[model samples]
Target: MTTWHCLSVKPEELRLDTTLNCGQSFRWVNTGDNQWTSVLSGRIITLRQTDDDILYRTPDDNVGHVEEVLRDYFQLDVDLGELYKQWRTDANFEKKAGRFMGIRILRQDPVENLFTFICTSNNNIQRITTMVNKLCQHYGTEIGTIYEVSKPFYTFPTVARLAHEDVENELRQLGFGYRAKYISQTARYIMEHHDETWLRGLRNLPYEECREELLKLAGVGPKVADCVCLMSMDKPGAIPVDTHVWQIAKRDYKLSGLASKTLTQKNYLVIGDRFRTIFGTHAGWAHSVLFTADLRQFEHRLISSEETKSNVVLEGTKREVSQARRPKKTAGVTVFDRYPRRKRQILEGKHGIVEKK
Candidate 1:
């Protein structure tokens, strides 16, 4: 393993577990130890945190200048200490921020972020992770392997790679369901009418302009566009209000506008504006921290409820229900592992392994 050290980062400034695994970016996988393996811009690297520093390893030495690459990917230049201080002036943010101190919004590739958030519609994190990884495995070039599991990592496919007609149909067969079409159509649209730099150029535009441009793509709605803006495009004020964020807004802020249980577009805007007003410049970052806290609490309550009812009968029934709801297996291939008719593409094959060329 080739290793490098990041001595500038502090434990409280960046927590790898919360930052990586918190449903923002999907390519990262936990290696069961403190390490995480992920593919970024076609380079595969494993990252782990010590008490005082963050460390990373990659197999390819010529990938070049690992320190700057990781620093940019993790957005480590952002002063989390200063942002936390700004957020703590408010009681609600103060409470939420304390629980997730080291979380920072990642600086991801814009087109990748666009397609990833499109898959996030009406989906949970587990399913989203599955879909994104499947997209990479099927369409993206294999980069390298996780040392621990020997599981190969793949890059996020370029827009050109995903723009083909067969990609849509194949993705549907691979269990992407409706999201397959969105991703496929969006890829085709960009490839025909625009260049890859089109999405990246939004960094210079205002948040509203960025959102407007993003919405022109297939399947990108306000939330998805706003997500791309906030997380990847440097629009820190942009808040993507999903159900969890909506609930947090109504419950904590007691917003008078939120009367309905469902979040309409109008309500979504209201919630976004409210948070923007409350959290000021870095509202999206603060909003994400709060949303993470709320999500964790909800998950904790769910697990506690399940454990409280874990009598033999309840446990058996839960297992039965879970199995019943799971997608049926076909010819020893479970639904999640299903692929298209085409042979899996391998970019570089050596030692019976595929790595990026």
Candidate 2:
């Protein structure tokens, strides 16, 4: 017999730290009310309006235990009281700066994580989720049961499974942009190196050395590597600086002088090193909290600007700030619903594959 427990919190019980994994939403199967089960993690996680924190069982067939491994990984045993006190009193820390964005670190499988973060470079949450879902349906195992929905879905594919498959063209057909190539390359790389576990051994090496190992991978750039380091490898404060982070650090943190003419590979190391010095060991975690909050603020402002609002307008020359700030749209768009379209030459005959032109 095995014992399992889930120390759950409504909002607080769940630490919204993206350090567990990158911010890819492991969508919950709405098994009735508020309870959520990650088929990947195989844990039924939930929050409550009650006094005690929530609890969940570790996924069955797991090598050991998922939640227990997670607890130690997150250092849930440590008391944050002293740290919170330090944060509160430090004026330079900027306590009243913004609301903390609630992010849950999803317990994704190791291989899924490798490929998922690889796809995350120069991408957004919505697009990443769509791509992951598409990959799962195309390559992953058919579990043969729809828990929450009327239709069916499946788990993510293993590296061994998807390596030889040409999933990229399919992704292109589905509008994945250039990410199709990255996914294809990463899968192939994994397939080529079946016994490669050298990455996991980099834990004790110097930060630069560890980061370099990550860079050796096809799609693992600075940000993606940093995300993997922090989330997958238990590195506390590996700040993954992207375009949004570059903007926020300059505009909000007054780090404009720190800005470089290029976002080159070297610059990523320099900038990340500087922040680690500034924020101490947990700087990476701090970056996560602050970055999320800052992004939410930007999102809110954009939304508010789009919505109806009434304010006094200046007389002669003043234009609405929102109007001036709006993004430019692509010109000249057309749609042909029932029009005669270009046709592919079909030779539907014996031993039929599409014939080479």
Candidate 3:
């Protein structure tokens, strides 16, 4: 095993639990004992955290500059603590972000981030994660596995591999559904017209221009483009408004004049612009904290201290408290049932579906 190294970061500044699983990047696998393992930039890396540090290691010493790779991937140069302090100035942000800290955005590979988010159309995080893993398993190069995980990890596929004629059928067989064609066509488009270098170069472009470039690709709508822009392209101001954000805007901020039922394109721009007005340049990052807080999976964290104490019972001299389980239903609706019902339309002669708002 490679020797473990430390990257100093406070718990309040970075929490792997929230950052890894909060519907951002979906490649990380939690391998018990607080360790997360994944194939990043063609290498297998494992990470664990303490209250004051992030501990990382690889399978062997051959993986040079592990620290550099991690620093870049995690965007450690940015001070999340300072950003938190600024975001807390807003009452709504302060309320929702109380239980959520250390939720920094991961600067992922553009190719992986783009294609992974293409799978996110009208989909949930769990399903998106499965599709990304299946894509890697089918087309990516095999990287050696860690002992903690039984299955071998693989590098994300190159554009050439995913652009192959058989990729769409293979992805459909692996259960990608309509997203299969999007992935294949986008891959082929990039390989034929633009390359990975060209895609990554968008990071240097202005935010709006970068988004425009991404919108020209197959299956990349306004939301997906914003997602790619924020997560991969150097666009911290890019806020990708989805159902959760739309609700948060109307319910929390009390922004009026919103469409009563659906999130229209006009409403989408309105929400993103509103968040930018509230949270400043890094509105996307701040929006993520609130978005994570609203997720049903994280609802248990919002329980007040008094609520936890109330759940406790005195049994003679021994005090026992029941563990908190994730709620099966929220407000009379099943968790998945609450997802927005999107209407998928087939654009004539296009390989992808247009999701009507």
What lDDT score belongs to each candidate, Candidate 1 first?
Answer: 0.74, 0.52, 0.79
Q: Which of 2 and 3 is ahead in TM-score?
A: 3
In candidate 1, what are the lDDT values of residues 1-357, reduced to their tens digit? 343433356656887877887778987887644567887767877676543345566766444766688888778888988888888888988755644667888989997899899999989888999999888889888877754677788888889988988998999999989999999899999989997788899899998988999999889998898899988999989999888888888888999979887889999989988888888988998888887777753344223243233332321121111232222322221111122332222111111222211
Error of 3 at 13 (Å): 1.5
The lDDT, on a scale of 0 to 1, for candidate 3 is 0.79
| Residue runs of model 1 more than 4 Å from their true location after superposition | 61-63, 297-357
Cα lDDT for residue 231, model 1? 84
* Candidate 2 runs further than 4 Å off: 1-35, 41-52, 57-66, 69-75, 78-83, 86-98, 101-108, 144-148, 151-153, 194-206, 259-267, 297-357
Regions more than 4 Å wrong, model 3: 307-357
- Clashing residue pairs in candidate 3 are none
Which lDDT tens digits does candidate 2 get at residues 73-140?
34565444334334434343444322232233333345666777876767777777777777777877
Give the number of the best model, judged by lDDT: 3
Of 1 and 2, the candidate ranking higher by lDDT: 1
Q: Kindly give the stretch of ten consecutive residues in candidate 2 with the minimal lDDT sum.
A: 347-356
lDDT of 2 at 290: 56
Model 1: weakest 10-residue lDDT segment is 345-354
How close is every model to the real structure, measured as TM-score? 0.81, 0.66, 0.85
Task: Report the number of clashing residue pairs per model.
Answer: 0, 5, 0
Candidate 2, RMSD to the unseen true structure: 17.3
